[model samples]
Target chain A: MSESPQLTYAEIDRTILDTLRPPTGGYWLAIMALIMGVLLGVACWVYQIFIGIGAGGQNIPVAWGTYLINFVFWVGIAHSGTLISAILHLMRAGWRNPIARAAETMTVFAVSIAGLFPFIHLGRVWLVYYMLPYPNQRYLWPNFQSPLVFDVVAISTYLIVSSLFWYTGLVPDLAAVRDKATGVRKKIFTILSLGWTGKHEQWRHYTRGYLFFAALATPLVISVHSVVSWDFALSVVPGWHSTIFAPYFVAGAIHSGLAMVLTLLIPLRKIFRYERIVTMKILEAVAKTIIFTGLIVGYAYGVEYFLAWYSHSAVEIEAFRWRALGDYSLEFWIMVVCNSLVPLLFFFKRVRTSIPWLLGISILINIGMWYERFVIIVGSVAHGFMPHAWGLYRPSGIEYGIMLGSFSLFFLFFLLFVKHLPSISMTEMKETLDLGESHGD
Target chain B: MATDISVIGLFPDEQKTAAVIEAMSGYPWLIDRVHSPFPSHKIFDALKLKKSPVGWFTLAGGILGFFTGFSLAIYTALEWKLIIWGKPIIAWIPFVIVGFEFTILFSVLGNVLGLLALGGLPDFKGLKQYDPRCSGGHFGIVATCTEEEQDQVIEFFQNQGGEVTIFE
Candidate 1:
């Protein structure tokens, strides 16, 4: 096999910084669309808050509707960053270098979007602080046993740690930007860079700090999603209650997450002409990871069914059967076809290498994962122990608008981020280039 | 600190930079620091620097975070004393999640603080001594030398294929 061509330091510097230049008209169009989405979502949310919880489609039994579905969806989308940045870094996967920054950026924005849902879901959004464990006048504290409480700890910790990890990696690169920039731009980067000089002492300590953070972040990713799964599993709902939920959720999170990385990066690479940095090789590697995660998720799906039958509980059996042939059976099969079947196409090199196929599969997986949550949340709740109390949840326009807005919000933050910061890590890319040249490959 | 005039040398090549660092070790001039576009194991080995101690700070933060997380859970459970079902007030099993999360939170806090303390960041004082080329593709060597030894250091840098400048 032929080795990749060498890139000079100047080439690396110029090409990476090319991303930070003034935005094109296309960029403005994308940003405007995202902004519109956010505004519409915001308007819907305001209407809901003012009018009350009844504006949502949720009713008896199916109390968790599109809001919880969107919440879990965004949270799952946030997983790839830690997976690519921390776990892949620990594993010393070199292809991760080009995509780590974008993935981590996604993690931060996705979590921020996900964080808002808890408040949006709360009919009393102003009283959200009651979840905090504090000594109050009423002697009230959030119950430790509540999975919702675990969510607070897990998600906030994920957000903080991921932000720090992203910022820490930015220091050296920010200094590089500072060196190259002028006027107000220079001042901003200077402050943001925290006076990094890339000195040996600084690099030494910074390396150790980065390693420690990555070490911590790896387990944090698993824990955050596992805790999210417990929000369902800990409940007595037949479909929701299962010991396998943790691993199952973690796998599904990563499955959708890897696809998202592809969805975002494939277009990103083409838009920025980063064909060299985010090479076909890198895309292929990511596609491979997608395949692996897909299988694990598929296995989890299979295991869930097998365990349901093995339990010999009529309710568990009915729950699984209902999911397959129930009212929302269309969504259940859509999820199966999207998540499990479409990903198998990646086994072929042609499919893995094709951008259109990658994008299509990624979009499908995203929908599949979203519907997977829908099936899990709405499917189980709609068919309860008492047939008389069972209910079906059809999402209202307000709920749909808010969900669309969440997507727009996520993209809005990312678009602004892409405009201001270097989308790729400058220092890491240079290091990779230098290593390549050092070996004279 | 003002009395000690500093000399800075810029190297376009990594091999020459390594040689310059090694040469400075034998002279009376105190090698202040080396700046490269990226971290180099070769440079660190040539300088014979000690391993950084930032990990210890992270360990301390992690331990502290664990206790803090436990305290928040256990202490609050004890205070609230709202018995849900027949479960114990201090649910150690479920509380482990809190402690685990806290351990990560504090570890990062500690890591960042440790980085700031050890790296001496947020101070732009060193920006004056910094050569922007060092961040581009060049490697920089900063040495502290007396006026008497300045000529020898400059000649050494020139001989090693480096561009020399005095740090103002």
Candidate 2:
């Protein structure tokens, strides 16, 4: 009687719950860090409110600061999450399930958090709403022709679409949670579950709907970054105005995004005891992506220089020189090493799967990626076509605080998300694992 | 505590309803679909399902999305126009981005409306009747049968099986 042939629904549910609810020792510490990060960030935002965008590193020539760069960097990092999940799903890649939801959530949160920078960068944060072109009595309207306007549209679209993609995947899972949780949680899950009954028909639509979104999302991943590139390309700055900027920016986004995923997940897998879910195989796949995208990104760098030389445009040439040999020359070289050279470590299969090495490479890639944006934004702006407008760009503590705080904000939401949802799609993983068992051995 | 029931079959279309139906023909049981999975185009063949109203919703959404996208684009561009010494009203080419985004935005809205129309969700009542294994890909088909026919179902399933389990 005790040994029934099939698992009772109770047992199946319990097993799933047990797997996700791994005990946490330093849960409080992680929480504390998130709180501190938020406090620092809020303080900085308040300061920006009082002192204006000037409190950060915005001056005559370089109106953009670390906030904008961070915005771009975080958005780039966020891209890989949905892009990875969608690509894998399209390919019917079996490895994607465990990683998809986490990746999707990451995209949603990072993109949303990154969305704040453009607003924060506004001198009158109060008047930032003016960026929106609402038809009202004031009669002022947002410029549709501005690349920044395009950015507003693209970023919002990416955010909304990616979020729907994320939340759609969670409906059935939420129902599962609802069944298990009680009282307030049960009520909350029930509401969020949106009456998902795990019915035959619902599953039918859900799958097809998710797939359609995946197909749509793939090009979007490319477009969002390309749109981001256009933000720079549309500008008259010699360094920024290149045709290759779109694809170059796209590849770099993927490169840096892959690196960030690795950096975040290495610690995440360990802390959550998801070693099995985020297996060595998964790490190897990530390493391969890093290598693949890194090559494209590095080529973009070289191409920037070559184009500068080939076009014989001295203004572009000067900007290129400034990127490599100017005061920020050290950053330029480090970008080369970290983004291009350091990623070479992934060439070795051993190092790719080594957790510590994976973490180091990822951090390097992230830094390199940040510097890459800095080169485009600050480098191009500081040493513009008109050297008369040239100026030094320095970050103030307020800028650093906001940047650090955004990181905290991202993590805080992500951490809570993990605890609440099934971090890995339990059902999807079991289906993959069960594939081998079906051989009737 | 453990008995493995394995089914190896084809998912000819999205929702894999056809796969489930094919399996059902062989075993007389009450089958439950775990959750909706991807590859959508198979609603008719798999479960003999009706077409979704998502298209209608999508159309409505597309219209709404157009207004939202265009209004935002036009208003923003006009607001504090950087009067670049007299550049053309920030060319319409840039407005295309907003248009493209609105199209997709409305499409998702259509999907949500379609979902709500199909079923006002958070189905606590119906959820209790379903199985988690549905999400796991094993459309669990529970056969309520007498002892005599049990072995035959088992044999048929073995020839066409993967991860089969029995209760009682």
lDDT of 1 at A47: 99
lDDT of 1 at B55: 88
- Model 1 TM: 0.97
Least well predicted 10-residue stretch by lDDT in candidate 1 chain A: A432-441
Estimate the TM-score of every prediction.
0.97, 0.83
lDDT of 2 by residue, A159-216 (tens): 9989988888777777677666779888888889876765556655565566667776
Model 2 chain A worst lDDT window (10 residues): A432-441
Candidate 2 residues lying further than 4 Å off, grouped into runs, are: A1-16, A19-25, A434-441, B1-90, B119-122, B128-168
Angstrom error at residue A216, model 1: 0.4
Task: Note the B-chain TM-score for every model.
Answer: 0.95, 0.49
Name every residue pair that clashes in candidate 1.
none
Q: Model 1 over residues A1-441: C-alpha lDDT tens digits?
A: 124667678877887888899999989999999999999999999999999988999988899999999889999999999999999889877778889999999999999889999898898899998998877898888887789999999999999998989999888888999999999999999999887888888888887788888899999999999999999999999899999999999999999889899989988888888877777778888888888989998888899999999999998998899899989999999999999989999999999889999899999999999999999999998997787887888999999999999999888888888878889887777776655522122
